[model samples]
Target: MVKPKDPSENPTTTTNNNKMFIGIVWNCVPELKLLLSALLFFCSLITLFQFFPSHLSFSIQDLRQCSPFPPPSSPPPLQIQHPQLQTDNNNNNNIIQQNGVIKRNFNTYGSAAYNFILMSAYRGGLNTFAVIGLSSKPLHVFGKPTYLCEWVPDSTGNGSGSVTVSGTKILPDWGYGRVYTVVVINCTFPSPVGIDGSHGGRLVLHASTSGGGDANFNLTDTIDVLEEKNGLLNSASNELAEFNKPPKYDYLYCGSPLYGNLSPQRVREWIAYHVKMFGERSHFVIYDAGGVHSEVMEVLRPWVERGYVTVQDIREQERFDGYYHNQFLVVNDCLHRYRFMTKWMFFFDVDEFIFVPKKSTIKSVMDSLEEFTQFTIEQRTISNKLCYLDDHPGKIYRKWGIEKLVYRDMMKGIRRDRKYAIQPRNVFATGVHMSENTIGKTTHKTEGKIMYYHYHGTISERREPCRQFVNTTEMKVGGKPYVVDTTMREAAGAVKRFELRMIGSALLKTRQ
Candidate 1:
C-alpha cells in the first residue's frame, strides 16, 4: 500500500507537473474501466436471472436433489344420500327399510334428546330423504316415491306391501322414553291432484300418495313431497295389523229421518253396520216429517218393526211445521226421554257425529266420564273464501243450498254457513271444529277425551222436497220483510213431483 504509484500507472492523474490535468491517453484507464464494467455486467446478470426464473431454468448447479411435489390426496367421496334408505315390501304395509327411524338416542347416544324428527330428503333425483328427530305421535314420514301398486315379493316370498325401513331412528321425548317408529310411505306416481283431472284443477293429494290423507300432519315445505292428514278415523283398512288390534269400542250410534232421493237402502245399511259393532243392544231413534204427509211413517215401518229402534211421528198429533227450533227440539226430546240412561248427551244435527277415544268402549267410556256434564257444544266458523271448489255454485255439487250468498257487508267478519259448514271458512275451524259442553257441571273426565264429527247437514231430510217439514223460515232485518219459505208454489210443486215416488211404495206397503 505504501508503494508510490508511477504517474503513468495511476490512471486518475497524469504526472506532467503543471500539466497534470491534461493526461495522456493510456491503456491503464481503459483496462481499469473494462474491469469495472465486467463486474457490473455480472451483477446485472444475477439480478436478471432472479427476476425471470420462468425464462431461466437456472440450475443452481449447486443444489441437485430437491424432492418432487407430493401427490394430491384422493378426491373426497361424493355425498350420496342424507342418510341411507333401505326399503322392504314385505310383512304388512310396504315398509321402507329403516336404519334410522329415529336419530341415535341421546342418553343412549348421549342424553338431552328433544322431541323432533329430521325431514332430510326433498326431491333429489335419486337421493332418499332422511328424518333426524323425535316424532310426537307415531307419525314418522319420509318422502319416497312408492309404487303404491301390487305387493313386491322377496327371494323366499310370503309378504304384502308392508314393512318400514329396518333399524331405529331414536326419538327421545321430554317425559316419555325414546320410541322408534318406522314409516313406509306409500306413493303411487301419476297421482290425480284435482278431482277428475278437470280445468283449474289443483294438486289434489291421493290416498295412495298422501299417507291416506290422515289429518293434522306436518309437511316439510312446498318443493316437498311428503303429505299426511291429521286425526284420521280408524277407518277401513286392508291390512291385518289394524284388524288384529284389540277391539276397545263397544258400538256406534246414528239417528235420522228419511227424505226423498236418499234411499232408505243406504240408511238401512249404515244402521246395520253400526249394529254389527254393538250387536243386541243396538238402538236407532227416528222421527219422520208427518207434516203435510203421514206417508214417511208407513214407509219406514219395516225399520221400526225390527225393534232395533223407536220411531216417533210428531206430525200425527198436530198439523205442525218444522219450526226454526226443530233441531234443538230433537235434542231436548231425546235427552228427556233417555235422561236416566243418558249420563252424557251429545247434541248435534243429523250430519253431526261424536268421535270418541279408540281405547275406550262407547257405553263404558261414556258412562265412566263424569255424570255432571249437561251439554257439550261444538261449533265451527266458515269463511267466505272458497277452498277446493273454484266455481262457487257450479254443477260439481252443492252442500247447503243452491248457491252460497256472500254478504259483502258480512264478508269481513266471521259468519256461519250454518246450513253447510257450521263455520264459514276452511281455516276457521282448524279442521272440523267442535265444542265439548257439560251443561253446568264439573267435567272431571279427561278434557279432550271426546271429539265431535260435525259434517255439514246437507243430506237425508234437509235437501229433498219430500223431507222438508217446515214450509217457512222467517227473518226480519231492520223491520224489513225477510222471510224464506219452502212451501211456496215452486217448492210445493217440486214436493208434489217427489211425492209420486213414495206414493207407489206407500200403496204397495199398505196393501201388503
Candidate 2:
C-alpha cells in the first residue's frame, strides 16, 4: 500500500542508491586490482616450483646425478702434456697423482679389444677413400670390415649424405708377432663422396665376420675425416686440385714408445744431439709409455718449451697386450697423424743416432734420395760396454754414452734390422723398421747416403757403460770384434756446446 502511494518518491530513492553503489566500487578499484595481482603471482610461483624445482633447490652435482641422458662413451682425448719444467713444483704432485689414476682407468676400460687406436680418415684420391686405424690382428680373421661415410652439408644448403662401402683390410706385415696391427680400411666409392674435409664428415667402421650378426663389434665412436692441412683448399678451384699438395716440413722424427726405467742423462744426450743434427726446422714426436717420469721430463722440458718436441702420454697403450711397447701401432699412428705435416718422417729408437758423413749434409743426402719415397738407413752397431784403454775412467764416465763408448761392434754378415725415413704422405702404414705399404719406391741401399749408430742396451743403463777397457789395437771382446770409432766422439764437444746454448746450465745438473 505504501508503494502505490509514492511511485515518484520510489524513483528518486532508486537513483540515489545507484549513485552510492557506483561511488563505492570506484573508491575500491586499486585494492581489488592489488588482490587480483597477488593471487596471480602466487599461482605463477606454484607452477614454477612444480615444473622446475631444481632451479631453487639443486646444485651442479645434484643436477648431474638427475640427468636423464647417459654419459659419453668416447674415450677421453689423449693428454699431450708438454714438459713445463720451470713451473713444475711440489704442488704438481697432486696433479700427477690424479693423472696416474686416470691413465690406469683408461687402460683398464677405455676401449674394447677390437677397437682402433689413433683412428683417422683420408681421401686417397678422387674415387679412392681410406680410413686408417690400429686394431687387433684378429680384426680380419673373420673377413673384411664394412665402412660408412657420413658427410656433412655443404655451404650450398645441401643436406648431409651417407654412403656404405665394402672395405678391404690392408694389414701391414710388421706387427712383430704382436696382438695389434695396422688396418687400412680401403673403400672404393662408386662415385666421389662429399666426405672430404671440405664437407667435414665422419667415418664409422663396422667389424663384420663372414657369418654376420657382429654389428655390435662396430667402433662406438665416429672418426673425424682429416684432409691435408685440414681442408685448406683453393676456393676458386676444385677441391681435388689442392688435395695432392701436402704441407711441408723439412724433418720429423717419430720416436718409439719410451718405457721402463729410462736413463735421464742418456735421454738428455740423445735429445740434444738429435736436435743439433736435425736443425731448426725439425720436430720430435715422443710417446710416453710409462717411461717419461719426472726426471726424464725435466731433461726434455726445455726442448718441449722451445717447440722442438711433443710428448704424448701413451701410457694407456700398456693396457693392451700389443707388440713391444706397441711400436708398430705407434709408428703407424704417427705416420697417418703427421702424414700431411711432414715431408720426410723418421722412424727410430732413442738408443739410436742418425748420422750423415761429414762430406755430405743431411739435406744433401735427403735431396739426392728425394726421388725415392722411403729409404732404409744401415745400422752400424756400437758396443754398449767396451771403452778405450788409454782414456781416464772418471773423465770418460762423465761424457755422453756415444762420446765415451766409442767401440763399434764389427758383426759381419749379421742382418740387423734397419730404421727408415719416409715421405709420410706417400706412406700408408709404417713400422719400427720400415713401412711395408707405400705408394712409391723404397730403397735399403742407404750405405754412404745415411746411417745410424745403434747403441744397444745403453739407453737404459744407469751406471757407467765402461764395462771393459780395450786397447785401440784390440779387435775382439766376448766373441765379437770391436774397433775404436771416433765419429760420434769427435762431435760430442760441439753437441755439448749446443746443449748449453739452448738449455743453459740445467743440462749440467745431476739427475736425482
Candidate 3:
C-alpha cells in the first residue's frame, strides 16, 4: 500500500543486490573498467595541455640564465689577455713575458724557498729539455764559463721515477741562455768551478731545433701545487704559447736619444712584435738614434701612409740632459696617459728587454704569484762594465772614467807618453755592483722575469774602444754568468779596503 515500499526496505535491497549481480553479465563490468580508464586518460591529457606550456616557459628561462655568455665583470674591468702573458698584450695587465736580460723595477716580492728541477725531454724527434726555476728570472749565465747540461733522447723515461716534481731534487743551475736539457752531471749541491759558478739552482739545458733562433727553445718547470700549478694557460694561468707576429700594429710612436747603432728593421720588428705581445692595441715612443732612425722611418713609411701609426713626436722638446735615463721612464709613463687602461709601459733601451725563467714575462710572472712577494731581482749584466750590448749613441765613451783615475797624478809625467790612452791588454780585477738606482732599490712587485738578454751576440761584440773594460763578455745578465757566489762578499771586502786607505791618507795629512 503505501505504494511500493521504499527501496531501503529489505525486499528493495534484495532487488538492488539482484540488479548488481545481473549487471555483471553482458560485459558490463569490463565496460565500466574501460570507461574508468578512458576517463583517467582524458584527465591526464587535459592536465598536460594546461601545465606543459608553463613547464616549457620555465625551461626556456633556465636556459637563458645558464647560457655560456660572458657576464659583466667587476668595475675597473680586467684587461683582455693572450695565452703567453707576453708583453704583446701590453694593455692587459695579464701578459708581461721576459724575453731578454733587462732588470725591471719590481717593487714587490719576497724570499721564499724555491724548488728548482732540471731534466731533458724529446717530442717527435724534436730535441728538447726541461729546467725548472724555483724563483723568477733566468738570465745569469753571462760573460763567463757556465756549467750546463747536454741532451739525452731517452731522458723522460730515465727520470729517477717520480710523478710530482714539486718535492724533487735540488734544481741544478745550467748557466743562463739554455733550457730543458739533461744536466751534464747530477749533484745535490752546486760545484765550485771556474769564474762562473752555479750556486743557486741553475737548471741549464740544450734543446734540438731546426735552426739557430727557434722559439722551440723553452724550459719545463713545475710550480708549487699551492701556487695553482695545474697548468693554467690563461694570461694569469698561461701555459705554452706560440709567437705570432702580425704584419703591423695599431700605432707606432718613436722615442728620443737612441743615438746608437740599433738595427732599423730589427727595432721595427721588435716594436711590432712586443706591441702585439702586450695584446694587439698600442703605440710605442721609440728613441731612435738619428741617422739610424731615418732609415727605419723610410721602411715604416708604408704603415704611416696607411695611417696605421699615429706618429706622435715626443722629441724636439726641451730635453732633460742630466737624467736622460730617467727621461726614458718619463716617456714610458706618458704612454699610459696617452691611452686609458694601458696596463704596461716597456721602458727598455734599444738593446734591452726584461728576461724571465724560460718564457715567463713580467706581467705573467707577477699575475701568477702572490701580491706580497717582496724580493728584488737586480739584473747586473756581465756584458760590459760600462758598455751596453744594445748600446745606443747616448751611452758615452767609458774611457773617461778610467782615464780620470789614471791621469789623476800622471797628466804631465812621462807616463803620458807611455800610452796616450792605455788600452789594457787585460783589465784589472774588479767587483761588480748594481747601481742603487737600478731595479733593486725602489720597487715591490711579484718576482719577475730577468730584465734583459743580448741574444744577437755578446757584449764583447758591441763594446767600443771607449768601453775598454765593461762588465763581462757573455751578454745575458741576471743569469748564471753574473750570479757570483762571492760577488756580495767581494764587494764588502773591497769597500772595507777602500775605507782603510782613505783613513790612512787622512791621518798622514793631519800629522803633516
Candidate 4:
C-alpha cells in the first residue's frame, strides 16, 4: 500500500490527470471546454468496452430464449363443412354428426312435448316444423341461422322439391305465454310421407346459432315422424273387434281400469255383488288403466274365464291426452266397443251400483222399455224421439252400517245428482258423465225409482281420475256427517254376505 504507484510505470495516469487539469483551465472559454469534455467521455466509453466485452455481445437465439413474452401466432381456419356421417336403414333410431351438423335416423316417433323446447313438433305429411314459442331468442344473433335438412340412407341426398325449408315466423297458440319473436323451421325428411316404415329413416336437422359457431341445435328430438292414422289404428281396431264381438247380453257396464288403494277385498266384493245382483243378464267391461294388483285380477279370474266379465288392458295403447281426457276417450271407446253387442250400455264407475226398485234386474228394466213408446228402434241410428234413461236422484252410502274396518272411514257418500244410462249405438259420443249427442233430440227424465248407490267415500285415497274427481268436484251437499240410506236394504245385505265370503275360510282357501 505504501509502495502505491511507481512514478516511472504510472506515467499514463499522470499524463491523463494533466490533460483534464488543462481542460478545466480552458473551461473559462465556453466552446473549447465543451469539446474537450466530449472527447474525454468518448475515451472513457471505449475503455469500458475494452475491459467488459463479454457483457455486451449476444446472439439472436439467446435473446429470444431469455425473453418473457410469447411468440406471435396466426388464427385457426373456419370449420364450415360437416364431418362424414354413417347411416343405418335397419336401425330404428340412430344419432350421428355430418357436414358440421347432427343427423338422426328413426323408424317411429310421435308427437310429444319437449321439456326444454317451447315449440310444438308441428308435423304435416313429409315436412316437420319447429313451432317456436315465446322463449326462443333471435337466430340472427348467431350469424345467419338456417335449418338444413337432408334425406336418409343416401348420405348425399338433398331435400326433394316437395321438401322445402321456410323461415316463416308466427305466434304460438295461447297458454304458451306472450309472444315476442318466433321462428319455425320446416324440417322435411325424405319421400314416402305419412307412412311409418316407408323410409325407416329420419331427416337430419342442423342449425347455425352464431357467426362462427357450429350447428348447435339438433331437432330430431322435437320432430315426430307421422304415419297414416288408420295404419296406427289398425292393431287397436283388431283388438276392439275381438273385444266387441257380439255377446248374448242385454246390459253391459263399462269403465276405466281399477287403480289406487282399491284392495283385493273391495274389488272382489264389488264384482261378486254385481254378479249376484244382476244374475247372468249383465256383463262388465273393465279397462285396466294401470296399478291394478294381481290379487285383484286373481279374484276376477273365474268370472273372466266364464265370459261374464272382460278386462281390456288400456295400457296396451299409448294414452296421449293424459288421465282425465284419456279416461273420456276410453269411455267413448267402450261405447263403440259394445255398440251393437249390448242393447243398453251402462257407463258407471266400479264404486257405483245402479239401484232399481220396481225392476230389480237391468234386464227387467230394458225388457220393460222394449214395448214402451218413449224410443223406437231403427236400422243404423235410432229414431230421434227418445233420449237416455235418467236415474232419480240417488243416495250415497255415507258410512258402513256394521262398523266393519273393510269400509274405511271416509266423509261417506253423497247423493249422485245427475247420471243416466244410454243406448250406445244411439249416442254419437260419450263424455265422462253425459253423452255429447244422442240420436234423439230430447232427453226425457225417466221415473225416479232408479238410484245410484255410490260407495265413493274412500275415493280420496285412490289414484288419478278418482282422486281428481273428488279434488275438483264442488259438492252440492258437502260438510254433512255420514248418513246410511236405510232404503238401500239390498246393498246392505250384499255387503254383509260379501264380507263373510272375504273373511271366510272358503274364499281364503280359493285365494291360496
Candidate 5:
C-alpha cells in the first residue's frame, strides 16, 4: 500500500471498491432500480412470444377449419301425443296440443288425411282414364274431398300433365264400424292421354278439403300406372299376338287378412285342398295380419316356392284402428291389384272350404255361370266342435280338422252370410262377403253350382276340435241342431295324400 499497489495484484480490494461505488449510486437514485426491473420483465415477455408463437396467436379461420362436435351417445325416447281439445257439433275446431305446442287434428278431421293401402291406374273400358286406391274413411261432416290427377312423364317422354277429376268415394255398408274404404277417381282429360301397355307412366293424387276453423290441409299420393299388356285399343287388331293374349291365371283367391293363433294343421289342409280344387291355372294371395307365424309359414312355404301362392306381410296394419284386421281394405286392394291378372276372383276365409259337386270341375262351374258378372255362393256352416260318433277318437282325431269334424249346422231359416265370386274386370268395388257395386247382374241362387263349408271358429282353435264326439243320430250340439254331413270328410283322404305329395310328410307327422 505504501509503494502504490498494482490493480492486478490487489483484485479483492478493487472489487470491493466497485461494489461500494454501485451501492452509493443505487442509494442516491431509486428510479435506477425500478427502470432496470421494468427492462428485465419486458425482455422476458418477448422471449415467451418468440418460443411459443402458435399458443399465443389464434384466428377465426383456424376454428372454421376444425371438425364438428360429435352427437350424443344415445337418442331420446319417443313421446306419444294425444289430442287436448274435444270435438263436438257446436265446436268445429279439431285442435290438438302436445308439449305446449298447438297442431291440427289430422286423424279426426279425415278430410285430406287418410291411410292408403294401394294406388293404381285403371283403364275404364277403352278410353276412360281412372285412378283407384283403398283408403281410410273420410267423414263427410268435415267436407267433401276434391281430387286432382297429375300424370307423371314416362321413359318415352309421352306424359306429364294434370287434370281435376271427379272422385267417387264408396264406403261399403260392410265396414263394421271400421275406418277403411274405397276411393275411385275418374279422370277426364281435355286431350288424349296416351297411356298404354308399352308406354307406362305414373299417377299422382292431390286431395284437399275444408274443415272447421283454420283447419285446411292438402295431401298427396303417388303410384305407378300398371301396364295392361292384353288391353285392346280402339284401333288394334290381331288378338292372338303376345301383347293381345289373356292373363296368366284364370282363377285367383283373395283371402282376408289372417290373424291370431292359427292351427298349422288346418292351414296345411286348406292350402293343399284349394290348390287341388282350383287346378294349375289358379293362384292364391294370402295377407298376414299377424297369423302367419313360423309354424304357419312352414305349412305355406312349399306352395309359395312352387309359384302357386304369394304371402304378403301386412302385420303392421294392426297399429291403426280398422275393421277386423282391416279385411275390407285388404280385399279391395287385392281386387284392383289382381283385377287383370285373373278372370275370376274369389273372396272367402281360410276355414271355409269351397266345394263343387261331383262330376263338375271348378272350371266347369265357373264356365257355366260365365254369363253372370257376380254370383253369391251359399255357405253351409259346419260344427267346429262336433264330430261323427263312428270316427275313431284316436285315428279320426289325428286327421285334419275338416276331415273329422263333419257335423253341419241344420238351423232352419237362419240368414247366414254368403261369399261371392266375381269377374274382376266387371267389378268396381268388392267386400268381404260379396260385392254390391258391380257392372252386371248378381245371382244368389248358386245352390248346386258352388258352395263353401265354413268350419266356424275352427281356424283359431289350438286344442282338440272333438270337444264332444256326438253320434250320427244326435239332433243337435250345444242346443243348435246339426246333422252328419260327410261331404268334406269323404274328400279328406285325397286332400291328405295331395298335401303329403306337395309338401312332404314332415307336415303330416304326428305331434308329440
Candidate 6:
C-alpha cells in the first residue's frame, strides 16, 4: 500500500497551501470569518494558559509566613476571602476578578472589616506631624497607601484637631510576624494644641489603600498620641546642644525593671555588682517594677541617698502587659530621662554583665572603639556568652571564687546579648537585646574584644531540672582568671554587709 503523504514532508508547499486557504476564508462571508477568529482566539488562550496559570484561590498563608509571631495553637487561622475589586479614578483598574466572576470592592478601612492592632504612637516635634505604629501593613489599591489620623481632644476641654490626609510610609516588621508600618500623618487644629505635653489624648487612624476612595478602615482603641517631650525628637537640636556642652557622666547603666517577684537577695546582688563595677564611671538608674522586698529597698537607699543611683517606682510610669515588654518601657523612659545629661547609657539586666576582658571598665572598653577609624561607633553590644554557675547551696554566705565558677560546663547554644550601650539621645526605640531603631550610625558588636556573661542559675532557691553543661571554657577579665568569682564575691559581700548592719541596727533599737 502507498504510504500516506505527511504534511511535514513538504514544508514550503504546505505553508503556501495553508496561506491560500486562509486568504480564501478571509474574503468569505462575515459569519464564517467571525467563527474563524473566535477559534483562533480560543487557541491563543490555551497557549497562554500553558505558560501562565491563573491564581484564583486566596489564602493568608503568604502573609502568615512573613509574620514575626509563631503560629497560635487555638484560634483558627485567618480565613481566605475573595477580595472585592473596584475601579478608581486613577487610570489603573483596581478590580480583582477571579474565574470570570467580578465581586464587589471590599474596603479594608471599614472598622469591622479588618483587624487593626495599634501598637504605639509618638507625636512629632512639629504641631502638624505624628508617627504611629500599625500591627500590620494596610491593604491598598495598587498604589502607595495614605494614612489620616484624627486627633479628638480629651474631655478636659482640649479642642478638636483636623486631619490632612498625607502619604503613608510602611516599614516591614518580620520579627513580630506582622508588618508594623510606621505611618506619619499631618494633623492641624484651629486653636492651641489640645494634646497635653505630658498627658496625651486619643486619635483615630483613617487608613486607605484605594485611590481617593472612602477610607473605611479605622483604628480607634488605644490610639494614644504620645507628646514629643524628649529633645531627641529633633535630631538637629540634639546634635547642636550636645556638640559643645560636656556631659555630666560618661555613661549611665539603667538596671532592668524588676517584676515576677524575683528573689530579693538576687536582686540585691545584681544591683551591687553593677554598682561596684560601673559606678565610678557611670551613674545607675534603677527601677522597682513592684514586688521588691523592703530589705532590698533598704540596701539600695544608701546608694540612692549618695546620688549614685536614681530609684524609680514602676508605678510612676504607664502600665503595660508582658514582662519584657514593660521592661522595654522602663528602658525607654530612662533613655528619655537622662538623654541630655549623660553622654551614653547602657540598657542592662541584673543577670547579665558586660565583661571587658582586657579593660577594667565598660567606659574604657567603649573608648577603645576610637581606634576603629572606619566607622563612628554610636552603640556596642558584648556578645552573650552564657556561663552557668554550679549550684552551691551550702555556700550561700561563702564567697564566689574561681573554683565555684564552672567555665567548662556552659550553655551549648549561642546567646545573643540584648544588653547594649548607646548615646542616650540618639536611639529611638529599644528592645530587650538590642535597639529597634537609632540615628544614622554604626554599631560595634564586640564579639571577641568583650564578653557578656549571663549568670542564669544565680538564685540558689530556684533550680532547673535539666541543666545542660558544656566543656570548661575560661573567660578571663583584665588578665585575671577568677574575674567572675571576684566580682560575684563583691556582690555577695555587699549583700552580707547590708544584712549584718540591718541586724545590728535592729538590736541597737531594741536596747534603746
Strongest candidate by lDDT: 2
User: How do all models score by TM-score?
Assistant: 0.27, 0.70, 0.26, 0.43, 0.70, 0.48
With candidate 4 superimposed using the best TM-score fit, by how many Å does residue 328's alpha carbon deviate from the native? 2.3
Q: Per model, how many backbone clashes are there?
A: 54, 0, 79, 6, 0, 14
lDDT of 4 at 266: 48
What tens digits encode model 6's per-residue C-alpha lDDT throughout 420-503? 667755655555556646665555556665555555535323322123322334554434342223433334555456545533
| Deviation (Å) of 304 in candidate 2 | 0.9
Candidate 4 lDDT tens digits, 1-512: 48677876788988988999998877768886787787666555544443344556454335435544433443655666544545555554444454444665534455222222332333323333333322223233333544444323322223233233433432221222221222334454443332332223344344433332235433422333222233321232323232355656667777755555455544655676677666666788988766355766776777787778888776643323234424544565566556667767776666655656643655666565653322221111111111111222132222231122111112434333455567665654455556645665434344554555555533323322111112111222234322223344436566557546544433443221
What lDDT would candidate 2 get against the real structure?
0.72
Model 5: runs farther than 4 Å from truth? Answer: 1-138, 154-164, 173-182, 186-192, 196-200, 212-243, 510-512
TM-score of 5: 0.70
- Superposition TM-score, candidate 6 onto the true structure: 0.48
Flag the better candidate by lDDT, 3 or 5.
5
* Full-model lDDT for every candidate: 0.31, 0.72, 0.31, 0.46, 0.71, 0.48
lDDT of 3 by residue, 275-323 (tens): 4334335455544323234555653454445343344433432232212
Summarize candidate 2's per-residue lDDT along 409-478 as a digit string, tens digits. Answer: 8878888889899998777666777777788898888888889998898777567777877776558877
Residue 450, candidate 4: Cα error in Å is 2.0
Regions more than 4 Å wrong, model 6: 1-174, 177-215, 219-244, 291-293, 315-323, 370-418, 440-448, 457-512
lDDT for predicted candidate 1 compared with the true structure: 0.31
Better model by TM-score: candidate 1 vs candidate 6? 6
